[model samples]
Target: MNSKSEALAAAKKRITDLQSQMTAKILAIAAEVEKLMDVTPEREVRDFLRVTCNLPSSELGTYMGFGRTLKGSEALLQKARVTFPVLKALVAADAETRQEIVERMDIGARIDTKEIAVVRKRLTEAKLTPEALMAQKNVRLVAAAARKRSADTAALFREKLASFALHLRKMNASDLALASLSETVRNDALELREQFTDIFGTSRRSLNKINLNSPAFRVAAANDALKRICEGRFGNSSHYAGVKKWPASDSQIIDVLLLLSGHPVPRRGWVRGRNAITELPPHRYRLKAIELCAGAGGMSIGLERAGFEHVALFEYNADAAATLRQNRPDWNVVEADITKVDFKPYRRMDIDLVAGGVPCQPYSSEGDQLGQEDERDLLLESSRVIAEVKPKMFIIENVEGLLHAKHGDHVAEFLRRVAKAGYQTEINRIRAEDYGVAQERHRILLIGIRRELAGSFRMPPRFPERRSNLGDALLDLMSENGWTGAREWARQRRDCPVFDRQGNLIAHGVLASTVVTRRGTPRTKEAARWGSKGINIGGLPAAAPTDAEASKPGYLPGLTARMRARLQNFPDDWKFHGGKQSVADQIGNAVPARLAQAVGLAAFAAIRGVSFDWEAMLWPGDRGRLQMTTPALYLDQPQLAPGRKKPEQNVRTVESAGDW
Candidate 1:
């Protein structure tokens, strides 16, 4: 224990020494910067202390090392006045002299130089006069008030400067730094313009006119400036290899610098181009696709993955249209309401597929469920376009609740309408989980095939098996130090159940019940099963659970990270973006990428009438040889009778009676 205490003391002393060294270095750098900008040392020190310590302007005088009011310390106050002209003027004038001048100025009474001298002489003779003292006090009070107002104004100006600095850093122009200057300082703007022009070799007017909003322009400027700075500072030598290794585009580097400096540029698009996969190999068949009620590019991304080249996309939201334009520069993202968009333009195009996920609110349980009455039922426009264009196939996806919708008759009527248009349709429920996503989402898919191709069309098979578990997906994401409950909810965890290494509850797994969202309202077992009274589980304290608490069963005691990951079907590499609520929402709304990939591959197979042998595609040279025990091909075989087995364990299973 004695040795441990000695070691701890030594460590603490080392830390204190390092901190002092860092402080000295920072102060030295600040002094050098002030000298370069021609700013006073005292003003520089004040600015440095305020920023480093995050001290407010009101507290500046109090924290100044000197044990005196800002005005009382004449020597220090004068130094400050160099950077604050108003403060200088106030400090230089005597209180009685100032009041007399103010009175004369206010009443428009001009005093001769001889009268001023007479008054000054009388005040000196009578060392203590009530009227004179009162006048002096009032002047001093006015000066203090003015000083306070100046401080407030200076603080606001500093905030603006900080914000601008942050913005410039984000733009990759970190060389520019703001100087603390009095309002009376001349040529500040000229100096800034000259410095910028000299560094970039571009005129101030031209630089100001460049559109930072355009990604192309921003990227170009960022790249050019970075190259210039690197070449000028490091020379054309291999020693500068480290500088060239930075992965961020010049614009991104600048943007980050600006943010750190205190200015944050407003992000414009979903993401930069470098982040997105913009190209893919073309499909075997020339699939001319059409988007119905497309809002931005959400559905478009899926359709493109499914081997469909969109010939036209219809959207009504103006902002969504702009977003589409920003991403897909050449796409025909028509900004017309689906109801008003005429189908005549597409009649002559060789349309192969019509794909869209119609809006769900009208059929949603939360809505009035006025299926046909809801104006959103204008899906008839999509059907009308399909009828006119006479596509070979069409697909419509919607929320699962649509299956049990009261407007079953309306769905039947719509089917009849599509039949009249000469197409056969099949409706099925698809669970996103079965497709390999972590989320247990169910969507209704309506597939319509032209009568001529009805016999050839077969629904894609379900995933052969579950590829991963919840634990497998999220194990990498758990904190290395282990979980810590949220600050507000930390106390609650004391009474909450805990999980063992294998994720089994120390207590029985059985609980009251799970919470669910129904008709947009959260329903919990706490209200129905436990009444308003709460139960204490294990050693934890009990509190009344709200509607939100009921819906979030995972937030309850003993819920493992793996369970949450399983529900979302997230890939091992996929990470949650927001806090717990955001993670939950994304998991709930996103389609599993694995499931999407499987569906995309299956759709491609159905369209081409071929199977995708993953092993064969990966290694074609081992076509005839058995490189590994695993088979090269996978198929959806029917279930067999109990106790039945294939002649070879690796061979495909034979279908039994009623297997279909």
Candidate 2:
């Protein structure tokens, strides 16, 4: 027995030794690879290692296998060099060649698969000659190339192909239809064909007749023939054309649609002539953006959708930082306390915009009005960053309370500090509902443009009409298969009060007010009771109403998952990562996507001198009428004493008829 025990111990020791040795070898290999690339960013090094080792692209899988996979085989390295030739060039070539290669690769990566599939299916259904397939592929490739290099030559090719496709789709060969299309699509097509014939040594007729359906044709096609005639050539446009022309014994249309389904369509198309080229107009002032207190990228998503690129994102929470990294590995997310971090990095980047809503605790109605000293006075940290970055524009958002806090002194001081930083400021009380969001959340938006650019900057136009309602946004989401954890919550509050013309209590369908985090104590007694029972409304104990309202039919428990989603302005298809509570926290913390988009669009338009209609964005309920009090004013006001003077009391009453 003793001999056996000794043997077992020896085996265990050997296993430990082997693990250590393996670990050392991996570290050495990683060091060598890092040195070879001359790259120092930890994240970049880690990503390179993963790609080198063929590690799974997902965070969970990569973490699980990181240790074991760090030491990749030499054969795998060779494969990587071939597969990622551009990356290899980046490590070995001259600066100009490396830049050119990287740009080309980026363009290649951005080409959407859906677009190619759509064109293929469309051509197949059209029954064009076999030659048309090559044309289609050529056009697709050219469009992809144009997008990547932002070149006019590629644009000309794309325009021609799109115009031809449009003409085919219309199927109106009439003089009027032809004229209409000629002025638009036909012209583009002619331009493309002309360009193709000029670029390729072969005549357009010869190039157009090739059979695209045959593998031999793809392999034998000349590079210039394929490149010039089609948008992109995997070869043989003629074979592709033949495939389309071939009779569909089966349901070709249905089959084509099915095949083309779920393909992503390109946002831009080429137009005919040098004058017809469409490009994003230059901004009057270049705007650089930075996100502060970024939480899991919700705000960043909206910002990007609005066309503003983030230079840096600051978040103190570890999990949220991880979430941001998982979604956008390229983003610069600083995982340190906001106060402790230096803002100099942003200054160095020449940031143009500083944005974030500091935690609302000290500014909330239910919290102690600690104005300057609140532990959450991180708004000052944001201010400090703004001062350091000296961006051309600064946007600070928060609960409406920030405006009215300290009887407006706090707000005034905040504005003063911003102006002192050489920016001209404008403050507005914005309702999310006014911006096509179904939520009734109100926020204080403080926009500051650099004094130099203030003259050209304008707020985004409002929508011409409200595009959604609470029911519109939530009903579909409440369906059984919609969002998880939402159906039960919806059912539970089926009898809550809904505001309609009549006094009748219908179901709660409209969005509720913003969900505030109450600190230290519950907002109401009911909330305290519910919190004690672990069933507080709105998912936060401090924000819930008192228990006396427990069985009351009109009172709603915190927002349903669908309702929360609507408030956050997330599309029904976008999903949250966590459980109901975690999702709720995310929604409550997010800046409504629609609001962000509106702001972005408006800024872009203003900077570019473009006209955008703003009147349409107001909700039907709010049309032609402003709310009685601005959100900032409402949030800043203290609870009035029972006998305190009211604004109405100060108004002079009109004389009676007898006096007249």
* Each prediction's RMSD to truth: 31.8, 28.5
- Evaluated against the true structure, the overall lDDT of model 1 is 0.46
Write candidate 1's Cα lDDT for 1-660 as tens digits.
Answer: 699999999998897676556534433433343353354345544544443333455544433422221223333322222222222232234568545644554555544445556666576647967887789879989999998987675455445434543544443223321211222111332343243344334633332344332333443444344333333321223333555323234344445334433454544232233322122222334366677765535456445445456566666655555545554544556667767656765656657777776776666654577767788775556677778877777777766556553555456556667879988777766765454443335677677877656655655556525423333333333222243333223333223453578997653111222112222224354243322112222221122233344346544332232334343433233343334443343333334334433444444445543444432221133234221111111122211111232232132221211100
Q: TM-score for every candidate vs. truth?
A: 0.37, 0.43
lDDT of 2: 0.50
Candidate 2 residue runs with Cα over 4 Å from true position: 1-287, 405-407, 481-509, 518-563, 571-583, 612-660
Cα error of candidate 2 at position 174, Å: 39
Cα RMSD for candidate 2? 28.5
Query: How many clashing pairs per prediction, in order?
Result: 21, 47
List per-prediction Cα lDDT, in the order shown. Answer: 0.46, 0.50
| Model 1 Cα shift for residue 114 (angstroms) | 99
